[model samples]
Structures are given as C-alpha cells and as structure tokens.
Target: MADKMLQGKVAVVGAGAKNLGGLISRTLGADGASIVVHYHSASTKTPADETVRAVEASGGKAFAMQGDLTKVEHVVKLFDETIKRYGRLDIAVNTVGKVLKKPFIETTEKDYDEMFAINAKAAYFFIQEAGKRMNEGGKIITILTSLLAAFTGLYSTYAGSKASVEHFTRAAAKEFGPRGISVTSVAPGPMDTPFFYPAESPEAVAYHKSQSMNGKLTDISDIVPIVKFLATDGWWITGQTIFANGGYTTR
Candidate 1:
C-alpha cells in the first residue's frame, strides 16, 4: 500500500479513546483518514481529545464522540454522527470487548447479559449501522480474541460472546459484498494490554507467552497494520476472521 493509502477516507473507531483502539484511531488518522474516535464514557474524553490532537498533528482530521454502544441507539448515533461530522463513512472498526475468566457454573445472569450485550449485540448493530451508512466499498472490522479458536477452560462467556461475531462477519460479508463492502474480524492472542492482563493470572500470562512464536503477548502494534491493510489494500479479503495470534491458536 502507498504511504497515504487511506487518504481522503473516513473511519469510525469504536472505543477509540485508548489502548489498541486509540492506536488504531491514531494510525488511521495519520494515514489521512478522517477519524470519528468513539469513546465509551466521560472518563476517556481526555484521551479521546489527545487521540484527535495526535491525528491532527500528524496531518489528518478527527473528532471524538462519546457513547455506550451496548445500546443500539448509541451505535446508530455513532454512525449518524460520523456522517454528520465527516459527511461519509468508509471504514468502521470495533475494538470494544470485555473479558472474564470464570467457570461457566460461577457466572451470573448479569455477567452473561453484559458480555453478550457488548460483544455480540453491539457488534451486530455496529455492523448493521455501518452497512446502512457507509459509502460504497467500505470496510467493517471487529477485534476479537484468539480464545475463539482455543478449547480453553474459563472465559466461557467472553469467548462465547465474541464467537458470535465471526459468524456475523461472515454473513455480513456476503450480504454486503454486492455493495463492495468488506467485513472481517481479527482475533489476537492474549494481547499485551490492560484488557488482557486483568483477566489473566501470572501463570496464565506465562502460558500465553509460551504459546506464541516469539514467546510474547500480541501487541497493539502487531494488529494495527492488519486493520489498516483490510481497510485499504487488503480490501478483497472479506468475511474471514484473520487469526493473528502468532502460533497461539489456529483453526
């Protein structure tokens, strides 16, 4: 891809205030895409501002919007606001997820509902709204966990909820292919972020590192290029969940 492959495009990054989401937002913005950096709450507003400033400093355009995407209305508003701000949507990336490491029997009703709400329901609606609002030949990407490919204990709800998005991506790919839209998911192995460490024990972290080819957890840097690729030059690869966990897990 060229240096500014995403130049003149517009992207909506869910949970774009910090961490992997923040990195993706900044990367896309730096690549010349006008970014709609969607943060989940007021606590992250400052980071959202920083992300926007970072993009602008890099010679790109961006603005931050706050919303709870678990509610379908908020998901709709995100895209609507993106179009309102940027006039069009060319790419949508959702990195919103929650992790839990409890046995199935120990999980509560509230836990299951919350997991599915953000991981599955929010994902489905995000894609739906994006499809409805995006310009032709747009890209839709979701960040998932490598546990989707693992026969692991615990994480029953975390993995199970994210598991639904693989199928959602597949179906969305076909349904939206006629419009030149590409929908795909990226599943990384025990990523090196706050999102990963809290749910893991010290021993579990060691085990995750052992499984990867480089004996390290996946980094946000490791995945940003993949998302950028799918959003630009790699647009042809649709409906597939790219397992980007080094050798951690594969199907």
Candidate 2:
C-alpha cells in the first residue's frame, strides 16, 4: 500500500470498459485508486463489469456505470456518481471518441455530427465535469490521435473533431491551474485496437505502419504508461498534447 503511487485517490475513467480505456481503469485501480468505470452502451456493460471485477480482484476498489457521455448531463452524472461512491476524484481520463475515414466529398452531415459529438463535444464536457468535481491537484486526460499532426486524407471528420479537444485541454489547463488541476491530451498513432482496425484499409494500414518505428502500430499498452504518468508524477506537464506515436507524426 505504501508503494502504490495513487493510494487512497479516486478516479473517473470515461469509456473505461474496453481497449485502452479498460486498461487505464485497471492500471489506476492497481495503483490504489478507487475507480469509476464508465461505459456507453449495454453491449459494453459486461466488459465494464469485468473491468470492475478485475480492479477489485487486484485488491483495489472499483464499480461500473453507464452513460452516453455526449450528453453533458450524463458526463455530470459520471463525476457525481464517482463522488457519491468514493467521495473524491483525483484524476479523470476520457478515452471517448469516434473515428471516420471517408472521402471528404462522401462524408455527410450525420457523419460529421456523430464524430464531433463523441470526439469533441464529449471531451469538452468531460473536462468540465472533472474540473468541477475533482479535488485540488487532480488531473484530466483526453485521448487524441496523431493524425492531428498528419497531412492525411479520408480522416477529415475524425481528425477535425479531435482537433477541438487540444484547444479545450489548453484552456482548461489554464483555468484549472490555480486549483492545481492539470489538463492534457495524449495523441497516439493508429493503434492496434479494434477501435482502429475497422476504420483502416489494408493499404492504409501498411502505409501507417511504414511511417512509424518498428513497422508496427501503436499499442494501447504504449499509451497507458503515459496516461498513468500524467495522472500522477507528470503533474507539471499540462495544456499540451503529447504524441506517443513512435515518430508517426510530430509537431
């Protein structure tokens, strides 16, 4: 217990039932933080339950909750419930996002709205709720994409929607600074996750693999350590998007 980096802390992990989010929830819980694992749909509830069980099985505390984070009220409830259960929030990591890879001309209004709603809008309000509910010195992290730094096509909506969160992170960092809350985003390259594979074609995948080191896609494992650092020891690093893409994209 004395060695746990986040002993006695509490965290609200958005979309924390699977993939990178699930790993984060488990990692934070292992570090001794009580966790609120949030999932978006009924289909994900089982994974949410599994995550909660895994967390507790690791000798940490955690529970599962459901919400459509695109709704501000749901986002609020996420934090509210975290406090209700754990009585404090020391960290929040929002891994909520939707990706699209369609020709700009073929993209529709519905496509753009859905992308922005899940990627940008949800990220914005997640930060808002975290800011309001977290105790002093808390941290907030959003998952962005390294495509934000790429001169690529077919990802206009996905990249565009995530672009908004960088600004939100910067502003929130400044506004939350006085309260000792650090806000930041982590941009990983095309990750080796189900969330990524469906959006990419074989040719696109090969090309993405070529640009990064090791001829491989980013792993959720690679990104999780950075998130952990930001939530704990990396407190001074705020208001910036750290690209953890293995040289996939820079600047």
lDDT of 2 by residue, 49-161 (tens): 99999999999999999999999999988888888888888999999988898999999999999999999999999999899987888899999999999998899999999
Off by over 4 Å in 2: 1-4
TM-score of each: 0.97, 0.97
lDDT for model 1:
0.92
lDDT of 2 at 118: 97
RMSD of each: 1.8, 2.1
Q: Residue 210's C-alpha lDDT in candidate 2?
A: 93
For model 1, the stretches where C-alpha displacement exceeds 4 angstroms are: 1-4
Model 1, range 1-251, lDDT digits (tens) per residue? 22226889999999998999999999999988999999997889999999999999999999999999999999998998888888988999999999999998999999999999989999999999999997888999999999989998899999999999999999999999998899999998888888888888899899999999999999899999999999998988999999998899998
